[model samples]
Target: MSLGGRGDLTARIYRQIRDAVLDGRLRAGERLPSTREPAGRLGVSRDPAGHAGLREAIARHAGVARSVRAGADDVIVTQGAQQALDLVGRVMVGPGDLVAVEEPGYPPARLLFRSLGARVTGVPVDDEGIDVAAIPDAARLVYVTPSHQFPLGVPMSPARRTALLAWAERRDAVVVEDDYDSEFRFGARSLEPLQSLDRAGRVVYVGSFSKTLLPALRLGFLVAPASLRAALHAAKRLTDWHGDLLTQAALARFMEEGLLARHVRRATRE
Candidate 1:
């Protein structure tokens, strides 16, 4: 490849490694040597050696746009919302941490927390959502699907929502709001997230675009208190440097243009 053509070659290599990581060929926590070292080791030129600028290029390619405003500092992009949850589990819950979850919540959330050494406590759910009174004081993190409980199509009631938030605050516990299908509440104005009520910094809200967009998009964000955002971001960086650059770019574009909201609207209407 010529000097100018090296740009295209670099993109290819970026995608190759990125795909490997995403595809399970390269598992999380696997170390990757310097790009140049890999190129040299593979008998290739340095054309594919520089990845410093690859992140931005990939972010743009993935339709992500950058912005600053309400809840900006707290959001960290991840491979997907699943990884975001995993990151939350890793950084927020230590061994034996009590995790309160909806009785019939997303199976993955419970499993992930358990995998991280958390003691999962199942709280009964109703149309109103997870019962706050049932929550154990030992729980450090309360994982709930407030907008809509998974598979049950249950949206937690207003009173229950308020009570849940208050419960989290009174205990100084962290609430991980899985706003997974929030965009699909359908026909009425969307309900405010539980995180919105968190003035005491006890809520760690999460959002994912996997449902509205393609599953392969693997895009999501976590809105937490400023104090914990840095730790979560550090965990994110350690997990995947900065997530898929191109995917982040594509999602940013989707967010910046309001296309994402439109798509969600259309889906909800249909």
Candidate 2:
């Protein structure tokens, strides 16, 4: 970092900028000064792009998109759920927006929402999960884990589910139902998702194959409301275009033949 008297100032400056971008200190589409200006500031010679290419490389590793949807629009493959959280926050929440999240839920979700310029309110969670009545007065989105509440590990109550749907309908708040790790439930009869019971067209279901499939799979899904499905699908498209089509086709066959169902049922009832 001292340049070691070898005049490697460009590499050092490149690294500094790269680290900031990768660490979320510099977000997607955030502008970097011209190569000459930074070099002047750093007492170095002029250059081109000021490591914009390196910054883009850092973004590629961070999995942050240049565009909101990132040009893929179909299936998004993140390094992990955390990166997905970052993506959702970056794309979904804007400044001064209100986003409702579960109380005592995952901290990273809260961070992601806040990072996206949302005023995040924590909705209380009971043994059965988020208390829909605890939702704030005016919120644009309700992000929940209706299938399996994090840490607490209890599915939302049926009545509360209906109540949430009603609330979303009245307030026009989009409901994002994260069914993370639902496939590995250790319980009785499997419960259907709030997405499945969405009659009001407000629920968006999200799931990851991290638990059921290999860690490197990185395949997650967003089953949106009929109205939002197109947009979110476009979001997915712009993000990565689609998951590996061959893998999806093969998995579709496996699921249709009852492979995933049997696996879920067995995992739950075992």
Candidate 3:
């Protein structure tokens, strides 16, 4: 029988034995090993946890390359940028909380916010990015792809970026800056990241290796404010315990050895 089949049988047998013992049908000195012992023998374990090395590497890269000041403590390794979004939605968004997203934005983000009971509002986007003036006054959270607006490919202008941050501060709102494709710039100088421009701790920067390296890797991270770091880590732990350890370790080595930078340079030139 397959391993799964054997596991099922073992569980059934263990339950039966427990019931027999409770009913005084089995002897006190039973020879059966505990369920955990057998599971351990089978090499099953809890979900993979995030690696510290990878988190540190990510913090270093973001600080050095993207001008985002993130420490390992402020980073949460997620399955991808999508999960980072989900985590933010879970922790920060409450029922009926207003969430403003770009109007033709990434569909998954809108759906995810809605699933968490947020009243997601679509704000129109133009060449300058999501129009800050159009954001609802009651919005508690704003999600934007400012580095390179999704699908439309327009970078959020510097003036608009400042306005958005100011609006977030005035409204007591949080801004989720999805820096998904900022690493591969074509010609123009990269605009300062919203997180870097943020002085009021309102921006949560989300990044993914999917666009830069490979989507199959499903590796991404969130650079949250010091205040939100604990809650984000708790949310991450509840959702998936952590991300894949092997992939994180490998990616950490790739980053530390400068392999990722080299690859990006080569790929951008091509």
Candidate 4:
């Protein structure tokens, strides 16, 4: 049945309960937890990491636009890029692990790593992006806003990108590439993401809809290597179980219809 209003929503829920009872899945005295599960039931089922269609859409979009090497299985939908960082940290970070971030960088990222018991340190950024040489040798993870550097608006130079990837490989560390706000570039050629250049699976590319679409949407995704998949999924399940499936479905349809590209073009022009 079509859900046109509150009445329709109620009727849909009622029908689901009725069907559950009929199937003997729910006993007569059993009570529903009365949470967002109702909404999940109202639409498609949820995946702890993300909806499958949305994951595929993200992979296709990033592969084409950003040259990110990812498949649908590598994409994990997140509450936002912040949660993507959180998941990465949960899986990779440990107490006393050194986490490097750009100086004068994103505060939330620094704070998040610190909260996870990581020894978060800020490495200075020059016109070339983060100074990779200054990053401590013991640092196991480096977070960078390379495409359009946070607050600085400087793109990481090609040499710097190569150097960062090399450093990560040498240290056996991970790099979290926050490619936020690259969609709105006006007069510059886009830089290839670190994830695209990372042959050793050292980079995790994160993107968000908060800047592209709407902040209230709370939509974001991360593209990670195959090795991190199982741990990332487990972290996602432990953190929130899953995101809003209906919104994910809507975004997937939007991307599949090519509306997102058109919208970005129009928005960039304006």
- Return the TM-score for each candidate structure: 0.72, 0.62, 0.81, 0.84
Candidate 2 lDDT over residue span 183-268, tens digit each: 56566634667766777777755556677666675555444444653444345445554345445444444544556557766765
**Candidate 3 lDDT (Cα, whole model)?**
0.84
Task: State residue 252's C-alpha deviation in candidate 3, in Å.
Answer: 0.8
Ranking by lDDT: 4, 3, 1, 2
Candidate 3: list runs displaced more than 4 Å.
1-49
Question: lDDT for model 2, on a 0 to 1 scale?
Answer: 0.61
Q: Which runs of model 2 end up more than 4 angstroms from their true locations?
A: 1-92, 256-258, 262-270
Q: Give the TM-score of candidate 3.
A: 0.81
Between prediction 1 and prediction 4, the one with superior lDDT is 4
Q: What is the lDDT of residue 88 in candidate 1?
A: 82
Residue 50 of model 1: what lDDT? 15
TM-score, prediction 2: 0.62
Clashes counted in candidate 2 amount to 13
List, residue by residue over 1-270, the lDDT tens digit for candidate 1: 221244444555666688888888888888875677656655544421112233233233222222212333345666667887898898889998899888887898899999999999899987777889999988899888887787676778899988987887788788888877665555564567776666778777676667878787776666567778668767766667655655554455455456766776688788
Q: Per-residue CA lDDT of candidate 3, range 1-270, in tens?
A: 222233333344556667878898777886765656645655433222266667778999988779998887778888999999999999899999999999889999999999999999999999999999999999999999998898798999999999999999999889999999878887776887999989999999999999889999999999999888778877887888866776776787788788888898888888
Residue 68 in model 2: shift from native, Å? Answer: 28
**Which residue pairs come into collision in candidate 3?**
none
Range of the 10 consecutive residues with the lowest summed lDDT in candidate 1: 61-70
Candidate 3, residue 71: the lDDT equals: 86
